[model samples]
Target: MKIPITAFEKEPLKDHCGIVAAFSTDDYPFFETGLKGLRILQTRGYDGAGFCAITKFGKTKTYKGIGMVNEVFSDGKRKNFASFPAQQWVYQVRYGTQGIVNDANVQPVLLKHRDGDWFCVAHNGQFAKDRNKREEKLSDTVLFAQELARSREASWDERIVTLLQSKRGAWSLVIATKNGLYLARDPLGIRPLTYGHLIDKKSGELIFCVASETGALEQMGVTDFFEMLPGTIARYNDQGLHILHQDKPHQTALCVFENIYIQHGAGRAHLPRKGNRQINRSPTIDDVRRKSGKILAREAPIKKSDADIIIGVPGTGIEGGMSFARAVNIPYFQAITDIWDEPYEQRTFMSAKISDIYQKVLDHFHFDAASLKDRSVVLVDDSIVRGNITKGLVYLLKKFYNVHAVHLRILCPPIDKPCHLGVNTRSAKELIAARLSGNIEKISKALGANSLAFLSVSGLKEAMYTPKNKNGFCTGCMSGEQYPINEFGEPLAHRRKKATQIFLYDNVTNPAPILL
Candidate 1:
């Protein structure tokens, strides 16, 4: 049977959803605190937002909408939603990497079990098993919650572990039940999950927080946070956090793209000190990007004479661009600025339609033509996926801004393979690098740049390596290397059938015309 494709499946690379949950010992409502954390993690996704809270009255309260975090929890709805007295909550900002973007796909998905127990789940990565036609209409997170709720396991923790261990793919999940909050990460560590604690000043009570990124925890005044180890499941309750189960160590395959593009630069990764897991030091994403930039300069050097000014793509590329300029001894200019007149901060990469993506580019980006006119330019970006945005920018520079030359430098290696783990790049055919057979010249010409260069896989590894992250990274998208674990998160030797093609659905009910 042919399955429908999703808008996300058409995009080159889309952002992953963000999940944040908090458990407070105090009686006060914790949904507000979870919302604040979700705001800080908004960059991870913006397709939709929602939260599920377990009220002090032993009731489940959920509110969701198809928009950003603030939009979902708008001013009019805030008073009523915040009035509830909740001690545990789970929140999600979605990008719908697996399902169509709509109200049905918005998370934290609240479901009731056969035993009449209600649970909510918010997930941050794609579930590999959900690619089949049977699950096409539902988002992976929703399907996961459904499976969990249907499980015959006597306890919530047992149900969570049983369901997660039996599946594959990248996931960092936060589940809320009347009993407490539960958190789990995939065995390969393909997605990021961090947990931290903050002290509630008034009640002198300790609050436990779990988030997809450290930035969210930091927003709640949490200075020290611990990265959840691979194949781990833990629970947060009135007694405090407890590790229920942890799978034996496997080759670590943390998603490398987090540091390169997805994560907020302000977020920090804790590194063990002197090989001691008990002692750790932290490095912000900004530091890693700058270091990567410095290394990229050495790997693909562009002298001052070759380019007059270096311009980093706004938002993610700024840090690396600045460091690249400093490393090359060239002047750096903020030539690209965002046009605030747009209704919302629309990310071009997040748009499903090519026309919509291009329109957003025209509406959102503004070039300082005065400073950039008639000058050689060094354009730095985090990565070049399908090359649409890069090509558009290059076209604007040469056609409108009249730049003399455009030299493009990318901090990430050429993504030749689709990321099956979490990111929405589903087919190699959609990647410019793979289509061009990894030819730098052909890729450069395709992007309308005079020259283009990408950081090597080894260079990326060197830049991202930290003591705590010594296990390794998942470069499957760049190198086409097989993961230590298959798409189902099981050992490769026991792998299931070949990877299945993901169907595209126009909406929850109808399948799109095209079939892969």
Candidate 2:
């Protein structure tokens, strides 16, 4: 049956990458310029965004989340000359809060290390906790950042040494200073970061760019390239880009989400696989949409006797409609604006009554009745999470359009499970599919569609992995690969042992690595 799309579909399945951008020479714009670079990462997340730029005065300035970049910077004007087109470095981050959401917690954290200078950082990927006394261990990340500042001699090499000394887990990082910028990923390479460069037309000078996605690099028109291998450090300075691979093994296990939903469809980042032929690394949401579309096209292309017009519900459906149209080779139209397309953008349309639902859906962008007058419309979406939005949209569509029939196509397999990683689906009350109320048809008809077609689990697995290249991904939310609560997230069984002070930062020498 059609997978009704839901808001959580866009959440990054994992903490993927961190974006660092800076103007070393007094040339490019430097006012939270990382924001400008990360604008391309909007598809990665819209919930929050933040950036920090290093200053020559050893002062670090930041403009952080709680709002859009434009909205956050709405009142502040650039007054510091230290950050851009002059003396500075920039780092930006998106996706996942790690439960540390605060202006204090927002990265890139600029602070003094043990050396006499300043260093700033932006990190991606989860840091493995002590598995016991997780909170005590959690405090260590800050202490670790503090310790790095304390132990180092305050130089470019020192910052690298300081970061290197930490036994912390996966992180894709950017550390900046007065002389240059240092970029590195964790030993495990659990996150993704890449760089390419171009010459600026305004100044006719060469520039290096680093970003979380290739789409960001492509926007700047840096076509010529080579990848910064995982576990490598890239430094930008007067001499130019200095690259060094980590002394630690550079083996990579690229986060699979980069292809599934993180990177926009520039599969050119594909890697060498199977036989030595290269494959695209990060796949785009559009790629998934296209495949879902192709699937719908194969399964149920519109027939002449079917409906007068063809319409996709919105967002997810838009692609499926195109797929169905192409598969059936018929006209595809934007039947309505997806109520959740700009899910967060609808906060202003709020009212107190359920009856007001119709008005809210209408107000937030939906249906162009002119084309939807009396045609059988096939609606496609990726998944239906809560069923509230889907139920509302169907009611709104039928009431407004004297449509022939409405068919639903879902690109994703039925979400029979809840996700534990970043998504907050531990509770069954939130998942409509998790209700296990009855048979599949009962669920589809209950949602109010003429017919429902869901991509089978195998189909979803094939569609997601084909064309793009990657091992396997964490599809725990769809197939019950895992339950929401992870035993790993649980603390080490502290009850048996006395509540000893566990320093989760720097070194674990206090207890030693000895087996108790």
Candidate 3:
């Protein structure tokens, strides 16, 4: 079966990694279940895939490779994973936000502590550095594993909590042990992690699942679902699920980009408010995009004489564009289609390099030029990254079809800064809007759009507000808003840097006696 593209304009954004774990009362082949879950949520990570399971005898077995989930687990390997012989399984799809993409850096970073205990850690979030500059070589996950090994804490849960408290940035983590599974998220809950369970009607066997997206859990036949509490630790095993630790939550600033562009288009962010304290309650991704579309239409109405029809850049842009067209009494058409040569490789917007993404867009996009001839088209897209996709599409339309004029509408506010969380835009210079000094008109002219309009930051905030998350959403990329925690005042990394230290499997980098 072909994996479908769900992004706007085939504009690649380096995706955040995804994690899924299943603990079953029956021997349900959790490894296979985890793999299938990863496949359903493949857009979250395309660089690498890995799975680690703790056998009944307290041994951890891990298989990792650099490629898509299917490519990493071929027919022969799938058979091997099917018989992994474990009740608990943790699978991670990596996009390498903090480290280089290689076999060693692939996740479900299995660690063998000197105390003779084995634990595997998989996470979704970008780890930030300590302002004081501590250990430098490994990514946050691996560095955490190393520090966790060195902890003098007695229990694994305590050690994990300590490590989480010490680090900064977004993290929703699942650490697997022979005894049980432990789950935790950063204080702000910037990234998403949901807890769910599948109950077998006849036997009453319960299978607990934790995943980065709700859609993955639903595909596994899960119905009892909810977001994993932020700043809390939960444990699951044969007995039942238990909350081990519940820390006070920090100010809410969950990544708004997830709702705007990253999440499964069908998924919803269902986080209940704690106690009487008000929080921002987000609508479903579809609802957010649709509402934003309506707001964009009202805020930036197009002249009927200037445009013939509205066209959505397929996938993510379709819902919002349709909403815009409906609000404005204009016809909406899916004039542009994404064409992929490989059935399974459908992510046209996952690459970090603009050149790589531009080439992919050129290879994948098919426009019905004849239909667009002499038409002033209203082109709606999710967000503008490097502005390559919009520019290329406009050029194609005008050059091939003699299009009269093209007006661009974006569903989100202008992205004026690079993302430091899990997104791929690492440098401010790489962002087209920021490069243009946040000048919308210049950006429009550069992209070849006759006129350009973007949703205002306040409008986007209004669209995403809920009774739960009433304060606001993360608009760091759009407005240069400070991030939560220690990442609040730090500068954005304009270029990729290499780590000086390495963790896992003995190396001379810091050859000291392993302690835990």
Candidate 4:
């Protein structure tokens, strides 16, 4: 029997990557544990997956492919890798925000030092600088690994610290070498990284694990964990985990988008409080999203008569939509359902071509035309990057679904600048908000919505941290402000000239420019 498939159009913002690493004192096999952790953090990336394993004898093996974790490390392949006993493991799921999305770019990138020692690194963020003419084809992570291998530093830990201190960008890296497992985060704290330990029940040996998110640690039954401070480099070896270097104190600029979209709902952040003594309070990403919705409702409330129901844009938007519906005293409905395509569910944002993105939207998302017929809908979504998907969904509701009206509510503030820290949106021209000068009315009209509103910058901060807390966030994309650091790994000043240089660089070098 043949089934007809309706075609629709949509797109989304893309995340960077996720990394996981494990080291055991007793030389226990950690291949399976690493795979499990990668699965838990797969939402951060899905374009490719790979892992590198180090045996007790210092022999290293690496496997990677351009697919999801399960597809790359299938049951048969897992068995093959498990046959080789390994004491240390590192895995990565990549979204390819930088360089080409091919086999060569896949991470857990293994490189040989000039001295003949081999090391593998899995990275979770993008570099701010462009590759030189010689290294144009290499991804940032691969180039980083090459540099580490060729460095003149006396030790691997010293090489990592020296290289990272000179580079600009948001990176959370897990490096595996014959000596030990090394983990590092960028000075700005623009990305997330956490490390934890679990005791083996039988051997009573300690196992150390590090990941871009805490959820992966939880999946491995690790309850006691600590978020790595910004600019810190640490290593886990036979002796134990030790801090190799900690960069001088700087203004922390954690990426706000992690709370808004990139991170999983279960992910949490430990916000530091200000008082006589510092105390950290944790808040789930889900809670922050829901609170953003509530704050949005207060800022721009839609009447019940105007909006009969609220529909979340699926996945990340669901939490915010539920809270928005409750705040407005309107009924919430799962009017949009995802049509899973077995093992190969396509992400529209990850598509390189606009045509492919639109096709994937039709293949993956199904709208309930019958339920939404002639009903006014308030569509809630995380953020509108290029506005292709938001515009397509709005047009479908009115033209095909026969919806009366669509009042679009975004959970975050209007993004008017490109993210230099790790997100895929690298050019400001591609951002609808940036194109429209952050004008609400114009953006709403462009999206074909009855009205549009975004949660304010202050509201977003309130939702993530306490009013009295001293936590800092990188709102450069929203406010067109200077990032904590510039592309040269120097502290950024509030100079318009520097901003202009960055904008010019992006326009000239960006390979994937969205055309409206």
Error of 2 at 392 (Å): 2.2
Query: Candidate 3 on 285-347: residue-level lDDT in tens?
Result: 888889889988888887677678898887678889999999888888777887766645545
lDDT winner = 4
Residue 17 alpha-carbon offset, candidate 2, angstroms: 7.7
Q: For model 2, how does the per-residue alpha-carbon lDDT over 1-516 read when each residue is reduced to its tens digit? A: 111133333332324234656544544554443455566655544434566665445556665664444444444543443234434555554444354444555556677755567767766555544454445422223444665676645466755655564544445666677668777755434455666666767676566667766666666666644455555676777677776545544333444334434455553432312321122343455666677678655644546666555566554456656766777766777767644433255233223344565565666555788787776676676666555555566666676776656666666655555443333344554555667442455555556666666665445555566544433344446532332123233322222312211111111122112110
The TM-score of candidate 2 is 0.73
**Span of ten consecutive residues with least summed lDDT in model 4:** 500-509
- Work out candidate 4's RMSD over C-alphas: 6.7
CA lDDT of every candidate: 0.74, 0.53, 0.72, 0.75
TM-score of each: 0.87, 0.73, 0.87, 0.87
Please provide, for model 1 over 295-390, each residue's C-alpha lDDT reduced to its tens digit, 9 standing for 90 to 100: 889888886767899998877788999999999999999998766552454443555455564455666678897999999888888887877777
- For residues 140-199, what per-residue lDDT tens digits would candidate 4 score against the true structure? 888888888889988887788788878888888888887799988877778888878888
